[model samples]
Target: METRELRYFVAVAEELHFGRAAQRLGIAQPPLSRAIQQLERRLGVKLLERTNRTVTLTEAGSVLLREGRAALDAVDAAERRTRRAALAATGQPGLVLVTKAGASSELLSKLLDAYAAEPGAVTVDVHLCGIGEQERLLRDGRADVALLHRPFDSTVGFDTEDLRTEGQVAVLPAGHPLARRAGLRMDDVTALPDLPLPRWPGPDGTYPDGPGPQVRDHTQLLQLVGLGRAAAVLPDSCRAHLNADLAAVPVLDAPTVTTVIAWPPHSRSRALAGLVRAATLL
Candidate 1:
């Protein structure tokens, strides 16, 4: 199917209402409906179930929606990468590296220093972003490489090198009784009735239903912990950055976090290769 038709169907599938999807696409409702119908005919499947007052995706529609989003993202990445290539051909060229803010601080610094010492090293722009934002940035070509922490970040569809693995710690209010403990299990922190764990945004940029305050980054979550409003479980390295108001205890049962340097599988840039090499060496 053509990109335009895929886009239209995706919009409709997501919004579940032709009127809203048409408005989102900045078009009239009738042509949008016609496009969906034509696409369904061409694909020989019922994409949507429409009623007088509601709209819903058919089994086929759900699969198309998932696949279409990936296809569109690939197209967008290709266009952006091509434009960047042209710019590199005629203008100052650089690399963009993205990672979650307040993560991998010491490792990132050492990696940067190591890469800078290499001969013919290009300027590397570092982007510190909110939770669940780095993967999307890398996927859409807005960033060249990323420092992804897994089980938190997915490394699918990319080439990655394992950097290091560390255990997790529970960050809590310093004055809380639990903060004085030698170590805690996952239940000790997760089931805290008073200091509910903070909810982080998912890949879809929506927070899961929870009782905790929605947080966007490590800094924000720490501030909340300091204020006795919430708690967080993060990589053990975070303990080094805790202040007087916040305390960290080893979460013995939490899964280990693995930091990986990731780039698109198709990348062949010498500078990117050098950066990844430096990271692995670190």
Candidate 2:
């Protein structure tokens, strides 16, 4: 019911282990367990199922986890917006724009130049983040806007405008058999027994179960591909950075990636509006 209770519930629900959740929350395990028990009692439902060796979420817990996460995000957004407002009242420099690192370099350069040329434009602070992080930065007011690639990044809670769309390419080691082809389909790349698709970390920083190596960003993924450890389906723009050791072949059947300018739905800053306008014009 309260923010503290929700925070505790989320931490425990995510970890599924009271001791680890307590450690993450910087509190003792018993207290964390008690808080969850109290929460369950107040809600009149079992949120977690616990035994000697394992802990798992109940159906109610699964529902609560999803709703509670959104509630917490709202709370965080409120606090962050208030702080940003206070800072702006004191004439803080400008808005922050976040984008995934090593993505859309050419488009970003053009967007920045266009926005800067506009009259009354404020100083823009660009924050380069890792994959799957742009949404959090926007939701929590750490960023005013983001350039997100659709199908890869979720745009569920934000307003967005399409900037560009391009097909995907499979980045493979130069000497790999598939790399010699002029173009290929998704099956050609995904079926490679030796070079599995790299698994990217979720927002929680845990890598999904897979045979391929886990990678955090484009640089790491490219390096892995060059070493023949992994293959990646990436935006076509990524070919600009590939070295001779790597080769990119068009993945004819892969879904096209659209780069969009996204922002929190409730944002009201004129500077943010101006930036969006400039970006759309590009």
Candidate 3:
């Protein structure tokens, strides 16, 4: 019921091992086990099933895990917003904008230029983050706005305006057979046994189970493609950065990626509003 209890429960639920969870939480194992027991008693439900070798969640634990995560995110957001407000009260003249590194470079340039040209624009601090990090940054008040690519990034809890949309391309080695084709469909690239698609890390930093090499960003993905080690589907704008060894072919059936300017729904800063307006008008 309390935030501390929820935190402990979430940690144990995630790790499924009291010792590991305790290590993660910087506390002793027995105390962490006791806290979970106390939490279960207070709720009058068996949250975890434990044995000599393994620990697993019960049905109630599964439900509580989901809801408790949301509750904790809300608490973190509240604390971050409060701190941000206190900082702003001291007359800081800037807003932090976050975006995926190496993405939407041209659009970002134009957006920054347009926003700077506004009559009362504040200093804009741009933060380049790894994939899937922008949403977290925005939710926790580390960033005031973000440029997110739809279908790649979730916009569930924010307000967004479409900036641009473009089709995807398959990035391959210049000498590959597919590189000579004028165009291709998704089927042309997906099942290439010789060129497995690279695996990207999920938000939790774990690579999905796959046969391909794991990559963290577009740069690494391109390098892999250039080495003929992997193939990747990327937004068309990425072609601007491709070297001669890399070739891009339009994937006729791939979904179009829409770049959007997103912000927290409850944001009330005048500078953030101005920046969003500037982006939309471009």
Candidate 4:
């Protein structure tokens, strides 16, 4: 389907009302409705169920909404990357590498230093983001490469090279009872009544139903731990950055986190390749 048709369908599916979707798209309702109808006819399936007062997605429409969003994102990213490429050709060349804030600092430092020493290295701009945002940045072409942790960050559509695999630790207030433990099991941490694990926002920036403080980044979570308001499970490497008010005890069974350098599969930029090479080398 055309990108215009996909956009019309996505807008309608999201709003569930042609009037609102048309308003959002800066078009008339009739044209929007007609476009969706033509799209459904060409695709040979009912994409939506429309009654007098409400509209809902059919199973096929649900699938298209998901796939259509990705397709549009890919198209947007391509346009952005192409424009950035032209800018690079005109002498503003650089690679933007993104990762979670306060994570893998030592590894990132070393990787930057190593890449800077390469023969034709360009400027590497490091973008420190909040939890689970690196994938989106990379996918949207705002970033050339990203340092992603597996099982926490999705790496489904990228080319990646595993960098470091480390165990996890439960971070708690220094004065908390669990802070004195030599190590902890997953159950021990999960069952803590006074220090529940902090809730992190998903990709949609909404926290799941939970009885923990909502947090956006490691800095906030660590501050919460320091204040004795919550607990957190993070990569063992985090121990190096812990302050005196907080403590990290190894969580014996927490799944290991593997840090990987990820980039789009379609990227052919030599500088991005150099950055990925530098990351894997470290």
The positional error of residue 72 in candidate 1, measured at the CA in angstroms, is: 0.8
What lDDT tens digits, residue by residue, belong to model 2 across residues 1-282?
Answer: 999999999999999888899999999998888999999999999999999989999999999999999999889989988898788779884889999888999999999999999998988999888878887898877888999999988899899999999999999999988889999999888899999998888977799998999877888888888888999999999988999999999999999999999998888888899999999899
Off by over 4 Å in 2: 11-42, 46-57
lDDT of each: 0.93, 0.91, 0.91, 0.93
Poorest stretch of ten by lDDT in candidate 2: 84-93
Compose the digit string of candidate 4's lDDT tens values, residues 29-67.
998999999999999999999999999999999999999
When summed lDDT is taken over every stretch of 10 residues in candidate 3, the lowest stretch is: 84-93
| Model 2, residue pairs in steric clash | none
Q: Write the per-residue lDDT of candidate 3 for residues 211-276, one digit (tens) a residue.
A: 999887788788888888999999999999899999999999999999999998888888889999
Clashing pairs in 3: none
As for lDDT, the candidate ahead, 1 or 2, is 1
TM-score, every prediction: 0.95, 0.87, 0.92, 0.97
Error of 4 at 188 (Å): 0.4
List clashing residue pairs in candidate 1.
Answer: none
Better-scoring candidate (lDDT), 3 or 4: 4
How do the residues 172-266 of candidate 1 rate in per-residue lDDT, one tens digit apiece?
98889998999999999988999999889988889999899999999988999998899899999998789988889999999999999999999
